[model samples]
Target: MGKYIQQTDMDAYRFYLASMEKSLATIEKYLRDINGFCSFAGGRTITKELVIAYKEKLIARYAVASVNSMLAAINGFLSFAGYGCCRVRQVRTQRRAYCHANTQLTKSEYLRLVDAAAKTGDERLNLILQSICATGMRVSELAFLTVDALWAGRAEVCLKGKTRTVLIPGKLQKRLKQYIKRHKIESGPIFVTANGKAVNRSNIWKAMKRLCAAANVEPGKVYPHNLRRLFARTFYHIKKDIAKLADVLGHSRIETTRIYIMETGEEHVRIVSKLGLVA
Candidate 1:
């Protein structure tokens, strides 16, 4: 017989997280979100109908993108709380096409953002932002970073639940050493609050927004994920190999990586010849 997670199943929740082997941060987020829903549904006993209704309520005030993420988080909680398939599949089909990602920061735009971060003179912030742009790491990965994660001129990130290693530039390592010495960061996470807690992803996103404002760059183009896109764009331009880019980004699907290749790859002369206007 399994015990239900009531409004005050704090201990059970912690035990659940440990049993599932979820990260502390992930466990916190799910508890907060699920508890909110539980509170809203009158002291914890809730149904799938209530979950769907709350999702709808959220959709009215927030963007579809955000609502989808919230739903996913809640669904995870439901599963852990022993609801198990109680939350209906929000995404009806695997065949449904996902929106294409066209919001990529070009190479020049990427340079401008890096220059902006540098001009601010926030050593740790500068290193973190610049390194992500150079290596195309996810912001969450940056939050979880330790000095030991850097090895053999590569920075490894277990992104989207997959481990991928990024090649580190020589200049980056030298700067990292200098920054480490100046910050007196000898161990644990590289990015932390003054109290030494890990810097969360929201903090990094907010910092990027603040940096964009300081640099007079449009905020939209300066998103953290854009650095990953920039990395894919830069690599494809240099190597012209989608397979190689896919491997680096740790993408199992080559088709998904192909979209990151900026150059449509149609040779200029051949495109003109096909039009017959070349004659």
Candidate 2:
């Protein structure tokens, strides 16, 4: 005996999330996951068994991490709707030591993408790509990169109730200053559309995807987050300080930072081969 999930429950949950200071992106994702579960429920009374069944369905269709993410959303909503007994456990997965090779974006590929953007004369895209890669900032944090922050050499990014300072490299700072001057962007976000609103993640993602063919990079590897990973990898190789890198990337856990800096399987194999244990 459980209450039927109603649209009112969903609306209230959304408002609750917003009140808790959840980012708009996070709220939307949670709602999307909840909506997906609702469709699966098909108006059936919510129950633990039904939630488990939904979890299994998700596991079959999505990757383990994605499945867990969806489950997290459902669990949160259930707690909010007073259906905590219906919450289902996320599937367990071992942490991956190396990232999949197919998705790893190499430095050379990143430069080629930047060059391609320049060739297309999309200066905004070109700078956006570089800014994320160089600063290792999330695409969502780009809005914090205003002309004032550029002059100050660091941007204070606030997200998910946590604030972190992202430093702009000296070289990148000079380039962005020139861009700001050329565009007469006296204040506010450095990146914006014709309407002067901060550019959204979807637009940045699409712009990056369009450069794949021209850059000779795989479409799967062309994304805003991949640039952040490239930055993490580069920083780790040079500094060899995972803790410092974690701080820079605004990761609350070093484990999350480890995922960002994972090498491809090929690189992992090559390094393991050099151990001389076989000889």
Candidate 3:
């Protein structure tokens, strides 16, 4: 039988991921999933059967998307460790046609969140929320929202070996300029902490969460990424151009952009009913 997986292998895997230039968050999540599989293994020698069993357990407990993500991590680690024979296949599920309404952040809810931030004297959080929703940029891309970009009315965002230009809406540009001047921010990223470093994803997430109660918005629907989704949906509604939207959102595939603009099941039903096919 083959030998059991060891801590040394996990350590080496971390080094490999770093060398590959994986983001810190990506490395942490991959390692965390690998560790979970290790715990399930219980020191047993890795085998295809054991890996499949773990995959089944994950399927029973998590959403299909989540199960696939964990399996991807495990398969990646197994391949890196030269144990590719033990990797299990991921579960295949049909694509969803509509997004869950409960998780969707409406524009009204977003406005309320901004209002809540303003009432609480969190000027930075208010602007941060607007910046993301207005630009369709990722939360991680917030660092690229610099003073220079605001002046230029566009930002050049580079991530994952790809770069795209994000245009700043005229209204949003005016507002951000006022914020920069009021805050006395001379140069560099307009959104920064007291130490002048760009605010990271975790900090922005927590700050946004604190506004849920005051905003009367569901906590589940409030997050930085949702702001980006709101942007995509709004842009698609206005322009009705999926290809251009895909380019604006920096998506290599229009299929991905479609997910961002999917209507809720209720909205889908409403539109279908208006077709008046029934007597």
**Candidate closest to the true structure, highest lDDT:** 3
What is residue 49's positional error in candidate 2, in angstroms?
1.2
Cα distance off (Å), candidate 3, residue 187: 1.1
Clashes of each: 0, 0, 0
In order of appearance, the predictions have TM-scores of 0.65, 0.95, 0.95
lDDT tens digits by residue: candidate 2, 1-279: 247899889889989999999879899999999999999999998989999999999988999999999999999999889999888888988888887889999999999999999999999999999999999999999999999999999999988789999999999999999999999999999999999899999999999999999999999999899999999999999999999999999888998998988888998899999998995
| lDDT for each candidate structure | 0.69, 0.93, 0.93
> Which tens-of-lDDT digit does each residue in 55-167 have in candidate 1?
77776787665667667877776776678656855533332232333344566666766777778776677777777778767677775456665435666666445677777
lDDT, candidate 3, 16-95, per-residue tens: 99988788999999999999999999999888999999999998999999999999999999998989988888899998
lDDT: worst 10-residue window of model 3: 1-10
Candidate 2 — which residues are off by over 4 angstroms? Answer: none
Models ranked on lDDT: 3, 2, 1
Clashing pairs in 1: none
> Which run of 10 residues does model 1 get worst, by summed lDDT?
92-101
Candidates 1 and 3: which is better by lDDT?
Answer: 3
